[model samples]
Target chain A: MRLLSFILGRAAVALLTILVIVTAAFFLTRLAPGGPFDAEVDLDPLVRANLERTYGLDQPIGIQYRRYLGALAAGDLGPSTTYPDRGVSELIADGLPVSLRIGLAALAIATAAGMAAGIFAARNRNRPVDALVMGVASLGVALPAFVVAPFLTLLFGIYLSWLPVAGWGDGSLRHWVLPVVSLALPQVAAIARLTRGAMLETLSADFVRTARAKGLPERRVISAHVLPAAVLPVVSYLGPAIAGVLTGSVIVEQIFALPGLGRFFVQGAINRDYGLVLGIVILYASALILLNLLVDLAYGWLDPRTRTGR
Target chain B: MLLEVSGLRVAYPARGGEVAVVRGVDLAVAPGECLGIVGESGSGKSQTMLAILGLAGPGARVSGSAIFAGEELVGMPQSRLQGLRGDRIGLVFQDSITGLTPHMRIGDQLAEVLVVHRGASPGAARAEALQMLEVLQIPEPAYRLGQYPHELSGGMRQRVMIAMALLCRPALLIADEPTTALDTTVQAAILRSFAKLKAHAGTALVLISHDLGVVAGLADRVAVMYAGRIVESAPAEQLFATPRHPYTKGLLASMPRLDGPPGGPLPAIEGQPPDPAAVADTGCAFAPRCGIARPACMADLPQPAAVGPAHRVACHAVEPA
Candidate 1:
């Protein structure tokens, strides 16, 4: 009964949050300086009436919101304004994989690099080694990816002439290097700082002293006791990070000219593609919810103290 | 002798300069002998115990020698110290709840010490852990091993700590302030269990605490430290019945008595210990705190004076520098 209540509670909140975000997104776009067809050429006078009736774009804002919510309930995301024949679901389905793929890859790399760097910094506290790694973390935090992207491109793409500079390639290892590096730097900084802070605190805990007294090897002491204890606070740090990488992959997709969803979302926004815009908004919300779920799961995994609701 | 600590001095850089916390303290423990080192906080009783286990923190400049079964431990590295701690010299910490890992099951944690020291197979480690818990007088040892630290009461947790320390049948057991934080009833049970375990293993025990009452019933011999130095050492009854040093007399008087009249002033020592800077100097640190201080007490540090068989004191005024 308790677990059932927990799941129900989470699902209810997620449903409410999704409704608020989708509805707010729909109306906020309408509040923008122009209508969905503002940038397009003037429609044929006779067929314009037919277009309005078919897509329900002719209705007032409230009615349109109501219609949108109704269709959403029925699993009907209306056809894209730019491509009237292509359903909204198809557009979303096509674009989502690219963003989710990069998000997951970046998550894995960031977790590994950050955890190692953090452990190193903690093990070598108040030393030259910690100074070097923290210096890199500061650089990662200070410089934006726009600056990092071009520099990385110049070094790997132009100077060494090793990887593709402006575009993602087809079916090859050559394609993944540029965008992956661009996406990884921000996460590395974030995770390393979080892990370092948490690990430092954990190493000072009384259990750590007790572990030493138990005669366990230093590696086992840090790995089993300190790392697991340290990872607890990093879960909260992951919340915003999940939002950043998964939702903010748009810039990277544009820089590398990847055929990912971020590029499609940007183009849709620029072209004022109404159905595609809603599709992207919904996709962003979904990513936020799922990543948060993963974070919550990780919380239960890392700390049994948290699991018992203490 | 199972454990012999001769001329052991635990020094480190104090804020001003180098200072010794446990200064030139010597002690020996035989099989099944319990030696209680009694003193107030910052008296270096705890530091002396840690010095024996080699658990003092970094840059803690130590010298002289700690020989357990004739193996020297003055400048031994941490790896060897780790090996010796559980397998040869089991260390029982003060705080039970904080000592046990909050997240780990009691059984798993118990099994861990045996596995690390004895390399017992998992099943054997688990079985031994359960048996040892039973030995500690923990009710339903097998069932309780699956429980987390918070699930058990304070006495139960301390018992678990004792069980972990005794699992390998170590030659020397160093327990620092074991019952200091516990209530009176729980304290009795923990002490009873310690006595039982000490007998079962024939382990030489070093019990370090500020509480004289806690050590009085357990100790065969008691060493009383004052301001980073052992000011007095004697057999338990001799120390209690006729405390030679004024500081030891003050400590015994300070304990809440069973025989004294009800609701009276507890005898407290007159002053706190010396400054950490002043403590490390080669002068008598406890002279300021000593009630019977003579002019000669502050000029120079006192050497150990032989009072009786196996009794020693470092006091210029009392022991004659």
Candidate 2:
């Protein structure tokens, strides 16, 4: 019962957060120095005014916001200024699946590989293996996706010819290798460091000593007693880390020529496509808020002390 | 003897060299006997037990011979020690709050000892855990089974700890300052539980504590330690009646008494215990703080000399019986 209320409370806060973000994005987009039609150099003023009137841009900001919110309430994201024939929702439908495929795959790989590496390093602490894992994690954090993407392409694509240089070919496993790895690398590095530090601290806790004194095998001690507490920091970190991976896929999508939401987000922002931009921002904000709620719920499950308000 | 430890020394690496914590200690506990080791913090009373159990943290250089049930423990393989630790020898620590895994339910933590050591099925282990909790007289034992460590009070948690340790019916149970972190009332309750445990289990016990009054009630034999060495050891009644070493005498005098004048200043030991790092090689470590110290007390380390039946004192001022 307490868990249900806790979840409800977090979900309510999440909705409020998304609403604030959408409101801020709506005004901030208008506050920027240009409009969607500003790039047309040879367009007549009369045509520009007609275009603005057709898209409701000619109306006062308050009326436009009310109209947008009303359309949003009815599940209409309006027509995209850049893609004249396509609605913002339709564009999102085309891009979201591709983005989700990459994002989910990268998240899985990062969480699993990062935790494994972190545990390995912690187990072999102060040894050569620990130094080596930490050194590579440092490099992963230091290098950006753009730099690492091309470098991987040079080594794995050009030099060895083991994989394709670019493009999503039928969205197969081979197609996912480069984009997913590049997106996941930095998050993996961050998680590894977090898990390693947490694991080290948890290993030295008094309960761990109690577990040892209980005559538990070392493996059982670590797996049952240490891992649960150690993974808490990693779980909390996953909320932001996932958001980062999703947004960071922008450059990877562009470089790999994939039809992901990140590509639409960047193109939408560049062309001042307000409908497309607002739609994508709302989606990202809602997803982030929902993910944070899930993380909180996960915390309640892992640590019972947080189950109630006491 | 259920457990015998001699020449037990535990040292840790420091900047210049190693600093010895438990220096050439000797202790023994017979089957079903309760031996109380009393000393202030850093007196090496706890370290001696930890080193014997191989629970001292990494990089500790433990050199000694500890025989438990005729098996050598000082250099026992970790795998063998793992087998003996909870199955044959149980351990309870001071801080009950941190001594239990915060995330684990009380029943699960208790059940785990039996499951790991005895290969008991989960259902059976849990049933046994509930029984153990009932044995410890935990209020609402069934309700406590589902609760986390943080949900329980400090004394309740300590009781859970004791229950968890005794779940396997180990031959010896070593409780290290089990009641130190509790209130006076709670401490009394825990002591009462320990007394009940002794009467019921017939398990040998090594109770380590800093408070003399704590050990006064339960311990059959009491060993007073100072500056990493045993200064005096005797039957509990005899030691309380006539404490030979000046350090032991000072420790007795410092304890708060109920019959004394209210708010009157308690007699405190004059000087601080010697720092483990700076303890000189050739001298009694407590000589500087000893009121009856002789010149010889500062010249050579005094070995334990028999003063009475099963009583030993390591002071230059005490004559051998």
Fnat of candidates, each listed: 0.61, 0.86
> What is the C-alpha lDDT profile of model 2 across B77-193, one tens digit per residue?
889999998889999998746889989898899998999889999999999999998988899999999999999999899999899889999899999999999999989988998
lDDT of 2: 0.91
Give DockQ for candidates 1 onward, in order: 0.69, 0.85
Q: How many clashes (backbone atoms < 3 Å, residues ≥3 apart in a chain or on different chains) does model 2 have? A: 0
Instruction: Please report, as a residue range, the 10-residue window in candidate 2 chain B with the lowest summed lDDT.
Output: B94-103
Pairs of residues clashing in candidate 2: none
Off-target runs (Cα >4 Å) in candidate 2 are B259-263
- Model 2 TM-score, 2 decimals: 0.97
Two-chain DockQ for model 1: 0.69
TM-score of chain A of each: 0.93, 0.96
Query: How many clashes show up per model?
Result: 0, 0
* Candidate 2, A252-280: lDDT as tens digits: 99888899898899999988999999999
